[model samples]
Target: MYQAKIMALLFVAGDQGIKEKDLADLLEIDRAALRQNVEQLKIKLINDEESGIMLSQYNSTYKLITKSEYSELLTKYFKTGLGTKLSQAALEVLSIVAYRQPITRIEVDEIRGVQSSGSINTLLARKLIKENGKKDVIGHPNLYVVTDEFFDYFGIKNIEELPKIEKFEDYKEE
Candidate 1:
């Protein structure tokens, strides 16, 4: 039962994955209980011969990922452009990153007034933005900046080519 809920949360978390602490808090269970449930879920997925997905852990975050056996099929799907396109939220995040290069995820969230981890992950996966380095702040959060791919995607040679915010204000109705 708890394993099912954990799977649902991981699925909703997308590629960003979820931290163990956050997961435990959401499930209203202690860390040990969460770990036990996650371990069971991992075993269940691993033992299911027909299951194409598995739980993967990186550092303290956990994500549901397709097993390597399906790598070829997944590659073909992405090559054919069948992969999901960016959502509105992702575009908004991209815009923020484009204008504010070397900004942290927390800063982006503050500018947008919402959590942007999913969108940030999407942009990172798409190669539109990348972690330039870690900020010197307390947590040393990653600082993201537009990549060369972003230039190609936007058809702009440089960041300065992006339209000025004042230009948009000029078009606003009085």
Candidate 2:
């Protein structure tokens, strides 16, 4: 059952990816049954939601990963203090991209109310922002998505895990 499969998954994971044939042979089950079991395990992991584990398939190889959502737990966190190394303009551009991604340089300029070519270029070169491909409508300006490295550098796993920033209203009220 699921319990047996789960145990097998954990044991087999140490070798990197578990081949379906290997699991079937070890468990004395047919490929179809093994497939069903693995699918069921994937569903179980995903549905648990609370657990930070994920069943990711690298091409055809399968393994249980840390979801990459709790990356901060596995790596160093980003610092926002002095001597930390991000330039003011870099921070500004990063902010824009992080908050307004799938957005282009034109839109970013509009929001920041200034030119941002240099800053955007720097971000791209640094791999903080990436080319997420063309927009759907009109000119199809390229979109951008933050990278896993970004999470690694910032010590945050997922975007939602970013530290809650004070609202503009809160700052205005102060």
Candidate 3:
């Protein structure tokens, strides 16, 4: 049953998925235990056809997503705007990625002057931003970019259609 709770959280995470290490940190359990939990959860879901959602594993990340057979219903929800709102930090990270895509997290943090891991995770979970790939730099950090969902959410036709920064510069108090 505890694994069920974990599955529920993963379901809420959407397509971005959560890393195995993050899941272990969240559940306060060791790596071996986390692996066992995930395996058990996978078996349970496999046995339940009416569950409508399935677990997906990729690059040591696990995501709980709806089964393709249910795409029609999910599409309807998307059309009806069922997505959650993002925090200010998420918006800022999204803007940085939108303008400077394929950027590493460190680069985004450098621009914002703060640790943006939380915001990046939130944006990824919301399907607004995605992992573009790893940078060639040291530690091979992941690069991020906006998804088509980003445009749909913002009502923009393309990335270039985003508002110009000069519009905000004109609002400076000085």
Candidate 4:
């Protein structure tokens, strides 16, 4: 019972996600017991229709994410005092990343017509984008891609569901 609360705390506090071992370590328990606690908590969140919270597993981490029904309330409750809004420049850089992900930072800078290192930092900090891996370029700059959190932000299941960006007639020409 108490373990569940601790598990929830670890899950919520960690931005990326929480692994089973971390939960176990928090409670100083064995794997089987920790797994059972997490499983039960997962069910409770799913079944509690009024809570508007759900457990998501990503990259081997579990996180407690708010459902759409409670987006506004949850956001308000968890809103960090830190200037929590994304800036216009960051938005432009995120759009470029979403459309051209698995792309290098230099490519993103080129599309935005500016260095964009600062904007990229902000986006990465916000979890809108993440390092996919290193590119094959000369310096092998890290590649970036929109994260699953981005889809959660937009309420979409996948990037393919993003509204299609239209190609201008002039730009479509050979």
User: Which model scores highest in TM-score?
Assistant: 1
Best to worst by TM-score, what's the order?
Answer: 1, 3, 4, 2
Provide the TM-score for each candidate, comma-separated.
0.75, 0.47, 0.54, 0.50
Cα lDDT tens digits, model 4, 111-162, are 8786677678878887989998898868989999999888887788988897
- For residue 108, give model 1's deviation from the true position in Å: 1.5
Error of 4 at 140 (Å): 0.5
What are the runs in model 2 whose C-alpha is more than 4 Å off?
A: 1-84
Q: Give me the candidate number with maximum lDDT.
A: 1
lDDT, candidate 1, 1-174, per-residue tens: 899999999998887789999999999999999999999999999989999999989999999999999999999999998785778889999999998888999999999998899899889898999999999989999999999999988789998899998888769576
lDDT, candidates in the order shown: 0.92, 0.71, 0.85, 0.76
Which candidate do you rate higher for lDDT, 2 or 4?
A: 4
Once model 3 is optimally superposed onto the true structure by TM-score, how far is the C-alpha of residue 95 displaced, in angstroms? 2.8
Compute the lDDT of residue 83 as modeled in candidate 2.
29
lDDT of 2 by residue, 85-152 (tens): 77677788787778667788888888889677667776786688898988887888878767776777
Question: Can you give the lDDT of residue 120 in candidate 1?
Answer: 91
Q: Write the per-residue lDDT of candidate 3 for residues 103-127, one digit (tens) a residue.
A: 9999999999977887898888788
Instruction: At residue 164, give the lDDT of candidate 2.
Output: 58
Evaluate model 1: give its lDDT.
0.92
User: Is candidate 2 or 4 superior in TM-score?
Assistant: 4
What lDDT is obtained when candidate 2 is compared to the true structure? 0.71
